[model samples]
Target: MKRQHSHLTPHHPLSGAETTAAEIVSGVDLTGRRAVVTGGASGVGVETARALASAGAEVTLAVRDTGAGARTTEDITATTGNQGGRVAHLDLADQDSVAAFVSAWEGALHILVNNAGVMASPELRTPEGWELQFATNHLGHFALALGLGPALARDGGARVVAVSSSAHHRSGVVFEDIHFRRRAYEPWSADGQSKTANVLFAVEAAKRRAADGVTVNALMPGGIRTDLQRHVSDAELARLRARAAGGAELEWKTPEHAPDPEAAALLWQDSQDTLAAKG
Candidate 1:
């Protein structure tokens, strides 16, 4: 498909310039931006929201719980001194909730981050009768985007950031087995397929949204300690932790040693720039 060459999708820009998150958004203002981040209450997602808000964006986090959600909002407000942060109830696996969110929301969206996903869990399904992983990870985002497409499109230059994984390289869309039908399933394979779909979702979305200034790009957030590993076994976690601490001689960045949220904030800034240019 890369050979088609019929259209242009944004590419990853060179990163040697050392523009950190805090730097890129330092003076930039997003005071009125209606930004929504799925899974923005924890880990890198929380960091992303903090950076955006620090830069003056009105950020909202879509999460699954109310207690933790309220606390996250309070913490972010305390940290950023910006109380625009709100917690919305949204389960990617539930299209009805997404519909509700879009209906209740009435405004142009500056940014939408499809960052919430399950890494590994016993196989599950949504109320819509779709597999839990692909349904929540891809189709849910897809539905949300489609539902919000018009509102976001009104601005003539909105952006969507689909947080993809390097695991995308591990598998393509298991088209036939998307729901794991006619085949026995392995948890990792499901995770791999979901990640690949994240990438392809951008590929497909950019192709369609490029002319309208809605740019979608996927990136590897390296590896951060998040609840994404709730399904990971204790043995697996210990082994990975050992390896992450120089025991595995791994070259990838880890949450502890990786650059801070300030480090990644610039990438999002450039992404906003790229989206504006594309339109």
Candidate 2:
């Protein structure tokens, strides 16, 4: 029997919440391709790097801790038997660090996974007075992508994957009070806005870089127990689980509700201006 859903966009046959990274990349040879995975030292980032390396791609772990990155690189190489895995320092919260990492890169980049991110941390601000979550999650990745734009476009057909989250449904970018200067801080709202920014970035970048064949996309890497939940209290976690068990469906924002070219453009400009001012 054939299922019919002509009104909906079809999902990939292999995609599911339980699908592992290895299964997805199986039999796909990436020999000679170069890949970068930020926050590759832990969580889904590690799995992403491993899968890329297993397929014969030269995988670089871009992490804040060089020691952890080196260890992860070693583990991935040992497990995959792909000796091309290496580590590079990348502190997403710091502009200088991002610039240094970008400047140090050489040759064309085939794949870039902006997989590193923070979630639901207490009210914190960067040295430049920007909200911590917004600065690291959105602005940093934005700067890194802009810096690597040429490298990605060099040979054309490069891919940039932004690992966003379902949390984006909680809120959109509050442009007027992006830094939480005037408004009171709430961890989840700040995190949600950053995640929303990630999606908006992919939307705008894909359109802008279409001429250069640099593809960009954002995805929600379904719920997994990860260190990303470090900031969530035990009580909050239990409450979330209870709600889920009660059959409360999340009000997911559809693609039609999300793509705002004007908002994307404004974010791009604002990001550039913010970076310029901070630098």
Candidate 3:
């Protein structure tokens, strides 16, 4: 995908430089609200969970590691004095876990943050034969969001946030062979495709659920060193640094901007049909 340049228009009040999540949601109370943040056990996800809980929302840390998830939830409760935080096991790479999580969810959901993702891993496939990056980063989140539609729509106003990445500019979704069945598997390209899918998923979700008072948004949280980069090698890091030194600035965009609606609708339907077949 080519870069869609914007003229530095500020859409939100907070700049990544100095804005904390607590500061961004200041003055708004989330008491009685229910929220979920996938991958909330560590990294940026932990901060997101803490901020939501701080605002008094009942939060569930959907994590792959139950032990880590429990610890993270405890830490958030201690730091924010919000005891509504809890943990639920979720492995985006596994469909059974997705369904189980959905089944266990109770009551109306006000906020959902599809923040978990895997990046730059070796060529791998889920049990369903989908590419690992696409499966975990996009399709799994897609399924989770759709599965939670009843809870989200129960409330008049709800929000779903997909944490995409600036890497989306590198490539679009490989629709024809999303699993890399017929193409060579390159780490960066796989990661880029997954990120692109995240934005498109949000776009379609917004379009379909707008009438239900549920809005979906995608965001690129400005670069931060986190476990998300665990798969990157020393050589890859040096290469990235070299590119950064050459004046390649990572572009961040608000959720209002995404791929065309046509592409989004197509991806949405494709994802729906894919998941249905698997079921």
Q: Best by TM-score, which number?
A: 2
RMSD list, candidates in order: 9.3, 6.3, 4.0
Cα-lDDT of candidate 3: 0.85
- Per-model TM values vs. the true structure: 0.79, 0.91, 0.90
Which of the numbered candidates is closest to the native, going by highest lDDT?
2
Ranking by lDDT: 2, 3, 1
Per residue, candidate 2 scores C-alpha lDDT tens digits across 89-180 of: 99999989999999999999999999999999999988999899999999999999999999999998899998888677666788888889
* Model 3 lDDT per residue over 59-135, tens place: 99999998999999889889989989889999998989999999999889999999999998999998889999999
Compose the digit string of candidate 1's lDDT tens values, residues 85-199: 8889888887778778888878888899899999867888765456788778877787788788887788877889888775554445554456787778767767766776666
For residue 30, model 2's alpha carbon misses the true position, in angstroms, by 0.8
Worst 10 residues of 1 by lDDT: 1-10
Model 2 backbone overlap count: 0
Please rank every candidate by TM-score, starting with the best. 2, 3, 1
lDDT of 2 at 17: 67
State in Å the error of residue 162, model 3: 0.4
What lDDT would candidate 2 get against the real structure? 0.86
